[model samples]
Target: MPSIAYILSAIGIAAGITFILRLIPFGIKSILKDNKLIADLAAWIPMGAILILGVYVMAEIDYSSTTTALPYLIAAVVTVLVHSWRKNIALSLLIGTATCVVLANWVF
Candidate 1:
């Protein structure tokens, strides 16, 4: 029942909104880059997130069963060691996840 022009107008409105939304971050990025407090917060936030995630994961482990917790402990250790030694996040995460998966499936 809708006219062709109505459908085209709706599509054009959606496309325009999407384009503007995509441009907003780039528009604000230059302003944020010059802000020292924002820069510090941005730098600290990822480390904070990692710490929170680590605490959450550790808290979920069952201490009563060594087998249940061993893989996670091992993986965490491996991840920390790799990251410390190589300073490569992607490599550390990949190795850590693989270690956990292998240990859980085969050793644990």
Candidate 2:
């Protein structure tokens, strides 16, 4: 049986290997700048990945509880609407976080 230290070391090695594998595309991209499509994709991939991750996080909210995530959903929607109207990201985030906190603590 592997000890905790061994398990941790294995995980570290695996993570390093994964990071190196992921870096291959970046290195290749630097060398392949002549290809317009590949260059565009390489540039957009990171931003697209972040957008997808954000959407996934928002979409994966648990709606059944009607307690924690529901408030967050409400707050997020309000925040987005407010930000759209006011163009204030900081205010929107603050409002959303405050709304969530308040709703979460509110007695039903």
Candidate 3:
């Protein structure tokens, strides 16, 4: 085991780091509040997230054959169409999920 002095020194260092880390959020809170950059991030991040999800999902699809691609393709097309018509994220996601599940399990 380590010496008591060594353990105390380590604990002191850890406590100092933790105190600084916890102090930082409050330190920057005023600067971040009502910032235009932060407002833009809140508005655009959702679409960016959705686009990243779409690209990641598309990248995983096996496009080598029709049997593998049809379910995903039909689901994507249905999702896009539903989103276009209704502009409802939850409904589009639900319908797309249902379509993929049914097609993947029952038909394909």
Candidate 4:
């Protein structure tokens, strides 16, 4: 059997490593804040992710079936319109998601 000191030491080591790993990102964030590349990445990454996701979603739609594609098309249109009009990301996303859900469940 392992001694109590050995187990305690193992636990302490694990906890210290966990804490340090979690802290490293925060420490680096300040250093990266002024970096032009990181700043550009921060601005573009979400847009890239959204674009990728939109492409993936569109690819899943059945082009032959109007019924299958209609809800997604409508929801995407509403999302863009809402975002353009209100300039609120959360509201646009909520409205878009709700539109998709309602149309998919009831209309489509």
- Candidates in order, TM-scores: namely 0.87, 0.46, 0.69, 0.85
37-95 per-residue lDDT for model 1 (tens digits): 99899989988988898899989989799998999999999999999999987898899
lDDT of 3 by residue, 1-108 (tens): 999999999999999999999999999989899899989999999889988998899889999978888899999999999999999988998999899889988999
What is the lDDT of every predicted structure here?
0.93, 0.81, 0.93, 0.92
Candidate 4 matches the true fold with a TM-score of: 0.85
- Candidate 2 per-residue lDDT, tens place, 27-78, comes to 9876787988887998899668856865896888787787757887887888
Who is ahead in lDDT, 2 or 3? 3
The C-alpha stretches of model 3 lying farther than 4 A from their native spots are 1-31
C-alpha RMSD of each candidate structure in angstroms: 1.5, 6.8, 3.4, 1.9
Candidate 1's C-alpha lDDT? Answer: 0.93
The 10 consecutive residues of candidate 1 with the worst lDDT sum are: 46-55
Per-residue alpha-carbon lDDT of candidate 4 for residues 1-108, written as tens digits (9 for 90 to 100):
999999999999999999999999999998888899998999899879888988899889987988888999999999999999999878998999899999988998
Give the C-alpha miss distance for residue 90 in model 3, angstroms: 1.8
Q: Backbone clash tally for model 2?
A: 0
